[model samples]
Target: MNEIVKTSAFIGAQPYSPDEFEAAIRAVGAERYHDKHPFHKMLHGGQLNKEQVRAWALNRYCYQEAVPRKDAAFMSRVHDRELRREWIHRIHDHDGLGEEGGGIERWLVLTDALGFSREYVTSRRGALPATKFAVEAYVRFVVEQPLVIAVASSLTELFAPAIHRERIAGMLANYDFVDDRVMAYFKRRLAQAPRDSEFALNYIKTNALTRAEQEGCIAAVRFKCDVLWAQLDALHYAYVTPGLVPPGAYRPGQATE
Candidate 1:
């Protein structure tokens, strides 16, 4: 174990009340959330042209594609029927029930408007290596981490509504290509993310009884924030300054015609 985990695991070092623990988790979001990333700032500020926007939509599809799989992986380990029942709704929200078409479908709508074919977006053929690595790491984290920490890792959703709101407003105001239909993903997430994050925050507050466990939960959120931030870093590195587009990753003018 690393020194940070060792320090966090030391019981009774700092016992937090439920409110304090919740604050610590929020603090992680405040400090580490990907909204602070430069690429997101550029995206929201209309600094990116159409292809840059397409690159983002394409790369982000990889994360959207992973959401239900990670949720299902977490659900698979739960023995409690009620918890499973509650958690199954997340899968429904992402993968959709029947023909309702959930978040993944809505995200593809954005990519499609950006001129990427559904096949290209879903195939993830254009995703950055760093984007794939970061997203897959999140799936593995949920699959391997203790259940409580796995749930806690999702607390990044607490910060999602603000970013989604920013995205909807910014994209609409800044880009001619963005309309309500193109931004349906963020609009839906405004409601879904809050509902999901509330349940997750309450779950952590109620369940993380020990100081060590609470710290671990905090670390989990921090780790998830890193996962998100890393994706933006990859985007900015490839599409922005010092533009080093890695092998087989999406490049400008490469969108489907």
Candidate 2:
């Protein structure tokens, strides 16, 4: 017991005030979030062709689909009833409640507008390998890491509402195929993201009580950012620049190129 306390003291050395800690967490998103990625710029700027847009939607389906699984993993590890109750909404938000519907369904609405069959998108059989790896890594992180760090990883939501706003407005303004219906996912997220991010931010700020814990939480945000950025990197590599589209992955002209 004495040794545990001594180790904890060492790990928590020079812990920040709550305000300072919150600032530090936000700084991580400012620096590392995927909004900085060029793919997003092209996506929002209407630089991508229909094919490129299709690829983005198809690949992104993997992430949207995985969100609920990661939340479930987090809930599985939580012992607190209140925490579980609070966190379970995240899953329902993605998975939907009965007839009410959900984020995943809305995302598919976007993809359906782009002309994907539900079978192809949900199968995830054509996603960039990196997309699969990154999404799985996120779920695994929540399952394996300390509960607070896993929750902190979700703090990327802190920066998401802005991007969703950009997506809704930019896609509608720029793309001929885009409409309020296709943009429903981002439109819904505009309200939902702020609500969800607030809970995650407060949870981390309150529970990441030690310096090491705080830094780990911040790094988790960076990790999620990397996960997001890497998907774009893979997309750019396979679809945009050299246009090498991986052997089994979707290319603009066909299901796989």
Candidate 3:
């Protein structure tokens, strides 16, 4: 692990010591993590109404569904037996192993509490175009980018635990509909994200040996931040302030009781 340090010379600089490179990547998360998005701020501050919260969960389901697929695509490209073995846990975490319901299933528990039918949520027909595009772009990014960068892209998990903590606390404090059961998805992630992120950060630091490679890792994290931030931008525009729900996207009142 590296001590956090600010640096502007991430790109086109001389090769960094592993600690400097790690610090540089962590800096990217410090500045660009989607926890800073206003939508999240509103969410954690209890400013959103139930419909708005429902909208967030409905839209976020799309991202949850795409995660396993992206991990699968990344695993398919890796030839290392040990790496593949290690990476397969991510896919299993989302998709589940046999009898255990995984993250996707846990997210649906939240949606179910929100009054959405499993069929409606999974069909994804109501998801915003922006959400669909951003998530698909992430999968495609992992498929198309170098393995190191694709792996590095998942470093967003490095920043996930804090947001999950805030979410759990805020929703529990503010909403009648929220409870321990609905919050299971986030509670699980507090443990899961740190484990996954540690593996990814270690991989990036140990494997990204040159200045150019390290810069690519940083760019990958930036691009992933864009992916996450863009989803909230769409959500906030459609549901929060301007309130321009896209033509085919989920509307606040559409969920079934």
Find the candidate with the highest lDDT and give its number.
3
User: CA shift at 91, candidate 3, in angstroms?
Assistant: 0.9
lDDT tens digits, residues 44-71, model 3? 8889999999889998999999999999
lDDT by residue (tens digit), candidate 1, 1-257: 23224544575576699889988999998898999998999999999988889889999999999999999999989999999999999999989999889999999888888888898888888899999999999998888877888999999999999999998999999999999998988888888998999999899888878777788899899999999999999988998888889989988986453
The weakest ten consecutive residues by lDDT in model 1 span 1-10
lDDT of 2 at 225: 90
The lDDT per prediction is 0.89, 0.87, 0.90
Give candidate 3 misplaced runs (Cα > 4 Å).
1-13, 255-257
Tell me the lDDT of model 2 at 187: 82
Candidate 1 runs further than 4 Å off: 1-4, 7-9, 255-257
Between prediction 1 and prediction 3, which has the larger lDDT?
3
As for candidate 2, its clashing pairs are: none
What TM-score does prediction 3 earn? 0.94
Error of 2 at 157 (Å): 0.4
For each candidate in turn, the TM-score is 0.96, 0.94, 0.94
**By lDDT, highest first, what's the ranking?**
3, 1, 2
- Shift of residue 211 alpha carbon in model 3, Å: 0.6
